[model samples]
Target: MRRLASFFLALYLASCSGPYMGKDLFGADEFVLDSYKIREGKLSILEMEGYSVAELGDEDLEEYQDRIHEDDVLRIFLYHPKRHDIVQAVSEIGNSIGYQVVGGEISLPDISSVKVEGLTLGEAKKKIEDHYARHIQDMEVFVTYKDRIVRKVELAGLVSVPSVPVDGKIRLFDVLSKARVPTDANLFKSYVARDGALLPVDLNRLLKEGDMSQNIVMRGGDKIYIAEPSAASLMVMGEVARERVISLPSGFMSLRHALAEAGGIPFTGDRSYIQVIRGNICKPKIYTLSWEHVIHLPNDSLLLMPGDIVFVAAKPITEWNRFISQLLPAFGGIEFIGKQCGSWGIFVP
Candidate 1:
C-alpha cells in the first residue's frame, strides 16, 4: 500500500502542468518564457498572458486606479471602426489629466500635453478603455496584454548555439528556428534557468507533442542557454568513478576526454574495456574502447554527444572473488580482527 501510494503521488507530481509546478524548476533564461516580471501598471490582469495573479488588496487596487498613464506602458486594442469619437474623447481625457500615450494613436485631440507613441490598433482601444475606467464618468474601458508579436529565436548546446535571445514578441518555434540546434538538444531532458535558479522545461514535448498550452510567449530581455550536449550526459550506472552529469567544454571534444573529465577510472575499474550505450531502442549500439587506446590513439577518440552514457565497468567476478578470498582469513578472528577493523571498518562499511 505504501508503495502504491508513492507511485500515485509520483505520477501526480510528474503530471503537473508547467505553471503549477514551482517556477524555481523552470530554466526560462534558456528558451524559457517563465522568468519575465511585467512592470507594474503596464498591463491589466486580462491583458497579460501566461501569468497567474497574486491577490490584490483594496489599497493596492486604489493605488492602481490613481496611477498616471506614464507610470505604465499601455497597450490598447480597438475593435469597432465606428468608435472613433470614443477614442478621441478618451485621448482628450488622458492628455488633460497628465496621461500620456507612450504608443498608439487616436483621432487628433487638440490636447498638447499627451503624445501617442507605438501602440497597435488593439492596444489603442485598450488604452482608451483604461482612461474611461479610471477618470471618466459612465465610461467603459477594455484592455488585454496578449502576445501581439512573434519573432525568431534559436538554441545551441555548449558546442553549438548557446545563446538564445528573447526580445519583442517571440514564439517557441521562432526560437528553435533561429540557430542550428544540435540533435542532442533533448526535448524531454531540457531545462530553463532564470533568477539564479533552474527550471525544468520539455523541449521535445513542446515541439513534437504539440502542447499549445506550453507554447510560451517571449518578452524583452529574456535569455535561454542550451546546455552543452556533454553537460547533460548520462552516468554509467554499473561502473565509473563518479555517477553524475558531466559538462564538456565547447569545441571538438572526444569520448576519451569525457572519461578523463570524470576522474579517469576507479582503482577497481576494469582497465581492459569501457562501453557506451546509445539510445533506448531495442538494439542499443554498444561500443568497446580500450583505456590505453582511447588515451594514446588519436583514431580511438570518439566525440561524445549529449545524453551519451559511458561505463567503465568493475573488474570481473573472478577477480572480485579472489580479492574476497584474500580477505577471508582476516575476517575469521574475532579479537585481533576487531582491533584491526576499528577505524578502517567504521569508515569503509
Candidate 2:
C-alpha cells in the first residue's frame, strides 16, 4: 500500500509539472530575459556600415548659385558718368526704387525692358549694364537685391522648429542653432538630403573637433534630418535587488556604476559568475566575469554600452528555491484529490 501511494503521488507531480520547469531541470540553455552588455569605446546606433563622409566637390559648389526668379524684387541704381542730367532725371522719377521682376523682364519707366530672370546676381548686373550702354555713355549699373521669395529649408526630428527661413547663404550649424536642437539629439547620425540623395554629416566633429569641413552650406529646398538619440538602455536582471531597465546617459558607464544603479546584487547572488550577454537575439555572445577578480583589476573593469544586459547570477540554493516556487501553483488541486480519495476510502495519507 505504501509503494502504491508513492507511485500515485509521483505520477500526480509529473502530470502537474509544466514543460518550462522540466526544461529548467534538464539544464536547457534558454535566454529567459533580454538585455544589453554595455562596453567601452564609442557606441553608435546609426548605421555607419558601408558609409563614408562625402567631400565637397566642384559639383556641390555649382549647386549654390543664387539665381533671380520671377517675383524677385531688385533695387536698381543707375548712374551716367558723362551726363549728370540723365542721372538726375532717372533718380527724380524714383527709378532707384524696388522693381519687381515679372515674366522674366524688369521694366524701366518710358525705357526698354530687360530680361533678368534665371540669371545670377552677377549675370543680371551685366545684363542691365549692357542695356544702358546703348542709351547712356560710360553708364554704371548697381543692382541691390531687396525682398524676394522666402527660401526655406525643412528641419525634421528633434528640432524645436520645423521650417527655417534662410536669407542669402546659410551653413548647417546656423540652421541647427536657429532651430534650438535639444542636448539629447544624435548629432553624429544627422544628415542632409539634397536632390533625393542623403549626405551623412558628423556634427560632433564640427562642434568638438572644430572640423570646418562638416559645416556644409545649406541651400533652398534642402532637408535636414536631426535624428534623436538612440534609445540606449540596459537591463539588470537575476539576483539584483531591483530588476529594472536603466537608461544609459550620453558617454560611458562602468559596470560598477551600472550595478550601483540596479541597487547592487543581493547577498544570495553568486558574485563569481556575473554574466554579460551581447549581440543579436538568435546568436548572442555570452561573457562570464568574476566580480571578485574584476574589482581588483583596474583595467579589467567592464564599461557598459548601449543595449547591454548585466545579469547577477543567483546561488544554486536560491535557484532551487525559485524552482520550487514555480511548482507551488500545481499543488492547488491536492486538497480536491485528497477529499475524493478519502470518500472512496483510498487512504490518501
TM-score of 1: 0.33
Question: Against the unseen true structure, what C-alpha lDDT does each candidate score?
Answer: 0.45, 0.65
RMSD of 1: 19.1
For residue 289, model 2's alpha carbon misses the true position, in angstroms, by 4.9
Q: Residues 159-244, candidate 2, lDDT per residue (tens digit)? A: 88888875546777788889888877655456678888876555656655566666777777889877666645678887888988
What's the true lDDT of residue 251 in model 2? 31
Write model 1 residue lDDT over 141-258, tens digit each, in one string: 4443322332223343532454455544455556665655566654333544434443334455455556544445543334566554444445544355666666532212366666
Q: How much is 298 displaced in model 1, in angstroms? A: 5.2
What are the candidates' C-alpha RMSDs? Answer: 19.1, 7.5
